[model samples]
Target: MKTYPVKGSVKLADGKPLASGVVVFAAPEMGMEFSSPLGDDGSFVLRSSYGDGAPEGTYKVRIERDPSKADSQARGGRKSAAPAPYPAKYGDESSSGLTAAVKPADNALDPFVLVK
Candidate 1:
């Protein structure tokens, strides 16, 4: 299937970058999903098994904690049980109410601002 470049950033309601996490794009209707890890600046570029982009479709978006970062924090004796960077609701696509549309061209999504 053809795919298009999709990129976006995540930030808190306070305007601070999320720093670390994973951004998920789910299109159940198409049985397609794409994800990318957030950069230190909270930027992300979606990629799927097919390539470095997502197929054209509307997707429900979700944000999740990056397991690698969590593991590192645990090894450092930090509280790995700390709350997610964003609200728990944002972690579930069903409840996140976040969506993105990928067109035939490049997609540069608006920043997803999360609230507590």
Candidate 2:
């Protein structure tokens, strides 16, 4: 098996650390989709399930939080089941906050920033 490394940072619009989020990779032209949830530090390592990694190209990545987790809190024992404050959006190289294109040249892209 082979693996490729990719680094990232997840944060809210306020510039606060966003502990959890999903990074989706889709190559519509090739009918492929690959995604991974970010770590606490908002970093990720993208690889292929079948060792068929993402092809070198600009892809539209959608990011969002886990649906199972409740994002609300209350003073009492009760908890708010409010819907997620942040929705997902499709991102390209330019929109992904990368100085370089989201291709294989340097094999790395800039940290993606998500608005609150």
Residue 49, model 1: lDDT of 80
Segments of candidate 1 deviating more than 4 angstroms:
75-79
Q: Count residue pairs with overlapping backbones in model 2.
A: 1
Scored by CA lDDT, what does every candidate get?
A: 0.90, 0.56
lDDT, candidate 2, 1-116, per-residue tens: 33344445556666765566567776666686667777767776566675434556656666656544443344376665664444433244324432322444335556665664
Q: List the residue pairs that clash in candidate 1.
A: none
**Tens-digit lDDT track for model 1 on 18-108?**
9999999998887768999999999999887888789888899999998888878775677578788678999999999899999999999
Q: What is the lDDT of residue 104 in candidate 1?
A: 94
Every model: Cα RMSD to truth? 1.5, 4.6
C-alpha-based local distance difference test score of model 2 = 0.56
